[model samples]
Target chain A: MPEKPDRNAIEVRGVRKVFGTGENAVAALATVSVSIRENEFFTLLGPSGCGKTTLLRLIAGFDYPSAGEILLYGDDIAPQPPFRRPVNTVFQSYALFPHMTVAENIGFGLEMLNKPKAEVKARVAEMLRLVRMEQLANRRTSQISGGQQQRVALARALAPQPKVLLLDEPLSALDYKLRKDMQIELKRLQGETGITFIFVTHDQEEALTMSDRIAVMSAGRILQVGAPRDIYDRPADRFVADFIGESNFLKGDVTGTDGGRATVKLSSGTEIRASLPEGFSPSGSVTVVVRPEHAQLAAADGGAALQGTVENVVYLGTDTHFHLRLDDGVPFIVRRQNARGGADSFAAGSRAGVVIGGDAAQVLRD
Target chain B: MASAEEIARAADRKDIRDRWLLSAPALIIILVAATGPLLIVLVYSFLTSAAYGGVEWKFSPEAWVSVFLERDIFDDTLSLADANITIFWRSIKLALMTTVVTLALGFPTAYFMATRSEKTRDLWLFLITIPFWTNLLIRTFAVLQIIRNEGIINTLLMKAGIISAPIQILFTDTAILIGMAYVYLPLMVLPIYASMEKLDFRLVEAGYDLYASRWQVLRRIILPLVKPGVIAGSILVFIPAIGAYVTPSILGGGKNMMISNFIELQFGQAHNWPLGSALAITVMVIVMIALLVYVRNTGAASGERRG
Candidate 1:
């Protein structure tokens, strides 16, 4: 079979999932539409109760959307049961069958599909090798370590050769070290299997490191869908900026506009240039988002630079954090690298100037 | 002043002694009150039966011999005791059937209860155990009232014109089976429910995600995971059912006698106390063997799953 690089492997069209009924109804996904390309590593990034897992469940056919369609390679699978779908999930808990051996767990999908015995054996052996768990094939899942159990779960889900593999926080249960290792391992497996991997996680770092593109969701709605660099460098709004990374929100008024760039007047009467959101024309007050690392401390020249008093100085090995109160009494944080001979040791209660880097400030539309 | 280590050791010894003293009463009661009658019955099995309804203090294996073999009254030849064999077969068969029927009924009911929300689960469990509040004999009689010729089932059928006359459901093996199953259903349900309630339902979701149908998920995952509870429930129901006295006597009408009823007859009408004791020992042996076989089978099954 030839792989179509440009075609969509799965498309969720205007999907809305409302749980419960009447007064108790809660919308977990509200009119969401996104397309996952073939063999692409897609991620749904959100915090708890943000409906990222709900979207993944809809794609895997474990859940049905209240109001829209889910298409797997052009065929609508919205009403189909999970068993009937050609997709599989790597659950957060691993969910390995405790009674079966690792090999049997890996072979379960094939066996359920009624594949031939020899075929199942061969596929299971291949999967065990792929997951680097050949030595633990005969071991009961209960006897395996958590990380090893995670590998077995991955092997089991991949053994079915699903069209799209939906991973629901598969590494959330692992320790920090193991989570890092599994993240790399998951990316490698996705590349090798050439399957469209739709991963869900709340860890922005994990999403940024592993996903080819991420859809940042908040409160049952997709805030922005873009590459990690695109999302980090140019967030669509204050919520996306705040959710993906630490950002300082400064209350500002739009003083002037120039195409995609706008001049915002800060409370301290300092006018700074910020990039505007697409097609948003702001005339009143706005929120300017600036990442901690985007601003640097300099001599308080008292001109064209936002000045603030250093409230706290925290040394954190590789970087030092300067928590300062801006002239308007708004708390702002600036992170400076602990480079040798390049450190600006500012004492607490000392006045400092924060020079916002060019094109780093993002003017929010709302 | 005594050394600290020596004082700690002495305190440990005293603690051990105190613990033993505290538990001694329960231990003594279990040994004497529980196993005391069983020991007497074991001893009586090897002694001779009195002319009336008691044992004679003389060593004899006649009771053990008569358990499986009896001398022909007219021919002076020993042969298999057909009546004893029949009663043993009936007892084993009914118990096995009752176990199977109760498991078939209890498994889904337990699963249903286990799947319910926390507040409602207690309600379901309470409902399952409601039958236990009544006396066992009364419960059996309640079943008799339902299945008897002039009882509710027959009257309903006659009224509905489904039958011209009442069905002779009572005084039959079916009646005893129904009664035993109803009586022991809670025993089967509770243990299985305990295991099922602890089950992680995510495993079922994983099974479905692996393309397993509903039936396949139940057969391959759910059933195997809950096997220990099934085995426990089966043993709980089967052991008492094999030796049940009341349900058989009431619903089977004394004609279809179980092993317990036969053993009772040996002491009452037959005046064979030694035979009754021997029969009781035999039932216990059968139960032990059944338990061993059950354990072995499940152990092998689990090994297969691992493999």
Candidate 2:
């Protein structure tokens, strides 16, 4: 037998999970395969009930896959129970032991290994200091705020020094500002600890902000996996592009193909050029995906543009969003800031041109 | 014209009056039927008995003193002094044993019921409570039939050649324990199920995720979380077991008499009202002390949780 590749921290191969039996059986995850690299912060992003949590539970060894296997650190851990795995999860609910103090909660995993009391104490102190929760060590979990509780949960999950930390929507419970702050903190913490982190969330912004690479899931199937920049700039399909951020899709048909670019005829009879995504087949209908920020506003007399009337202008403090409708009643969105001069104060029903460059858009087959 | 405050006050007065009008008859019945008998029992407990028979109106500390001091009175044979004390101790022991056994059996059953799926949980809970809806006396008599000489147990044992003769299971302390435990088992189960039902099961999962074994999860997390249920179920099972009249009288066969049976004997065969009242008062005092200790222990335990 040949030796296995050693770059992955977790290698999930053809894993499937089905709940119930017979006619009532429902497939939660279907032959999902991914190799998570060592010490990289990976995210599984999807809508609710999309089986991201199920995949996380499978990797944590809390549940077993009905088919295939999960390998951790080059070892198959399909039969190992959660306690036997060198991975710990910070649950969505935090799952802190209400009866235990912060210190006891953080020290529980070390105590489970029958560590010496002094060692447990020192490690617990270190973890508390890491989370900046040393002062709240004696407080009961119920006595602390939600953010503090979140810190305690992080301390508890991290104190064991596991090879992988599984976080199931850990920041979903926090307020908006706190959630934003934690996203940065979590990225820094992952770097400082150098532990492979697999974070699950329905919030696309969160996935993009903290993860080194993101596996976008939908209906139990992984649609695409790539770095944040790659995923945002070069989405493999329409679903991934739409789910990640705001995108204006114009239905089109491929007219010509060059080295790596394609010319497509839009529904409005206007021709545009875009980079062809990998594995692009030009025979069928396709969509051109352009980010809202990439679409610029120009006078209607300018060349190579689609004409539309400004339906609404929304002032969003830092930037403004323009809702435009074409003559054929096709709606499109264009985001503008004060720096872009064409439409800082366009009125409703004003004729304008929406211009997107060839490099800013990608032609998607599906 | 009435001001807003004056009108609101008038409306509140009318609401109170309407409630009083609706509840007046029930209040009168409660005052007459319930409080009247309790007042009589209190008055009887205080009054001294005349030498011939009738109760003396004059108050006296004689009965209280007889129970507390004058140790010889506890040994009095004619007045059922010795029997009363013996029955009291036996009742307490039986009650304690029954509570302990019920807890040992009921806790796991309740926990299982609480953790099961909604449909299966309802089914199990119904099975536990089905026996309670049946006649209590019929269930106790059914136990008699099962343990008798020609009962199924005896026939099976005989056929298996485990014993040459039927075991004397009826009219014994063990029989009483079995009867009382079966009769009060649902009461023990319901409160425990209620407590365990409200328990945060994530706490147990957290324990396991933290590397605790199954036993440690149970002892440190599950046990402490469901302690309120244990205490509540114990008190519920013990109080009734101590004052239980029918089960012990039917199962104990006069040999294992409890306080309830002694008190009933004074009221029936002996026709000794004052002594019966005194014995009833003693039982009440013991129950109060047991409750006090339970409350104190529970308070201390919760205090520890908070600390």
DockQ, candidate no. 1: 0.76
Flag regions of model 1 displaced more than 4 Å: A1-4, B1-23
User: What fraction of the native interface does candidate 2 get right in terms of contacts?
Assistant: 0.60
Tens digit per residue, CA lDDT, model 1, A270-290 = 889999878888888999999
Scored by TM-score, the top model is: 1
lDDT of each: 0.92, 0.86
How many Å off is the CA of A188 in candidate 1?
A: 1.5
- Candidate with maximal lDDT: 1
TM-score of each: 0.94, 0.88
- Of candidate 2 chain A, the 10-residue stretch with the lowest lDDT total is A1-10
